[model samples]
Target: MGRPAIEVQGLWTQFGNQVVHKDLTLAVQRGEILGIVGGSGSGKTTLLRELIGLQPPSRGRVCILGEDIQRLSAAEQRRLSQRWGVLFQQGALFSALSVFDNIAFPLRELRTLDEASIRDLVMLKLRMVGLRPADALKMPAELSGGMVKRVGLARALALDAELLFLDEPTSGLDPVAANAFDELIGHVRDGLGLTVVMITHDLDSLATVCDRVAVLADQRFIAVAPLAEVVQLAHPFIRDFFHGERGDRVLRAAAQPASSPGGA
Candidate 1:
């Protein structure tokens, strides 16, 4: 509804002779959840790294929250980082740290908070992600797959970021857990008033959570629109991605007649 939270103009990223993205331009509006999807090796993660300032683009500008990220000084970049958070493909929690410490990591880096305040903030973050207080004492290795994801999410939200990035958030969970996680994301987004940009291959997730989807191909987004509108497109990749065999299954499921109470 407001201005763009992220703006990329003429973004070009290259790894030696392989160009991952070329002239890629897009703007992610504030308070929206946008999913980016493409075939394997379509540069989803690469694009995320570029946006987060981990991977610098060979050409073009990346602006975050109205400021040109690439032009910012070291100190300014660090300050801007506090406004956003990212959950990588596999949670990526530090194995050496307990869940509590992982959630507290970013807060500790601020070096301004006393231990008591840090504990209180960390507990709040854990609750926001649906984790229990007892979980704080467990190391990453002790958590189950779903619990690990929640802890990573807690750590990501620990800084109270308005913008969130998720890379395959539901990748390893069972269908039940995946659906629950999707609902959790929706709840958290609306509850926190956060802007989320996610890179995911889960179609059900797109149908359930994303407000819009950006389909990447030929080194650029061929379409960025609501799932309903984008799924109707005839583009080869877009059509197959949304209406192919797997997509057909999703569609078929959606078309199934709902059973009446106690009736087959």
Candidate 2:
């Protein structure tokens, strides 16, 4: 097989006396969705920052699409960054910009497309994320929780990025909306042939769209495998997370046939 889309080796993160990651490593294959889950304060966000070059690891190597991010020059890094997109937990839309302008932000930054072309591409992205053209005129403040996520997703795909990073993609939505968002993620990934790495605590999302799930604990990834296989591990966190009341409910729901829209 070819090199993985993302690869981390001997990673370590430290903040003064506190060490966040210790010899952590992982690999994400091309065109697959990998879910990252960890308990509170497990440094999931920190790891993500390092992976995307927002923050540097104390000692490690991070490679994305075969380039070592830490070794890249500024111009090279900027060019490489355009190959991937990120969706922050709260959608992180520009408060002052309308939906149209928000989705157009990245494209405009490229300074390559004219206004007419930008408009056409923005509309296409909006449609790809299941939003209406008229909705593009609305401000971020006017959007619902689900709408915010959809808009964030649309912007994430605006660059036609080969890799997508999602921080808590399905948080703050009702079960139905979250499920719908998960379906949209799967649809978008397959349609765009994108490799996705998402940090999510939503079990329903893991069960629904993730090709593999990675658990972070004890300052490293404890297990990275399919949900069923990971759940079978002897780790305490795995047991509590997958066999607990909430986990059991989600697992049961996932095992059965697709339920009606009214179901959680």
**Number of backbone-clashing residue pairs for each candidate, in the order shown:** 0, 0
Per-residue lDDT of candidate 2, residues 1-264 (tens digit): 578999999999999999989999899988888999999999999999998999999998999999999999999999999999999999999999999999999999999999999999999999999999999999999999999999999999999999999999999999999999999988888788889999999998888788788999999999997776777789888887888768776676556543221100
Best by TM-score: 2
C-alpha-based local distance difference test score of model 1: 0.86
Candidate 2 lDDT trough over 10 residues, lowest sum = 255-264
Give candidate 2's error at residue 136 in angstroms.
0.7
Consecutive 10-residue window with the lowest summed lDDT within model 1:
255-264
Clashing pairs in 1: none
| lDDT tens per residue, model 1, 1-264 | 556888999999888999888899899887788889999988999999989988789999999999898899989999999999999989999999999999999999999999999999999988988888999999988999899989988888988998899999999999888988988888888888888999999987887777778999888889987776777778899877788778876554434442111100
lDDT of 2: 0.90
Alpha carbon lDDT of residue 216, candidate 1? 94
Candidate 1 root-mean-square deviation in Å:
5.6
Q: Which parts of model 1 are misplaced by more than 4 Å?
A: 249-264
TM-score of each: 0.93, 0.95
Model 2 stretches with alpha carbons more than 4 Å out: 252-264
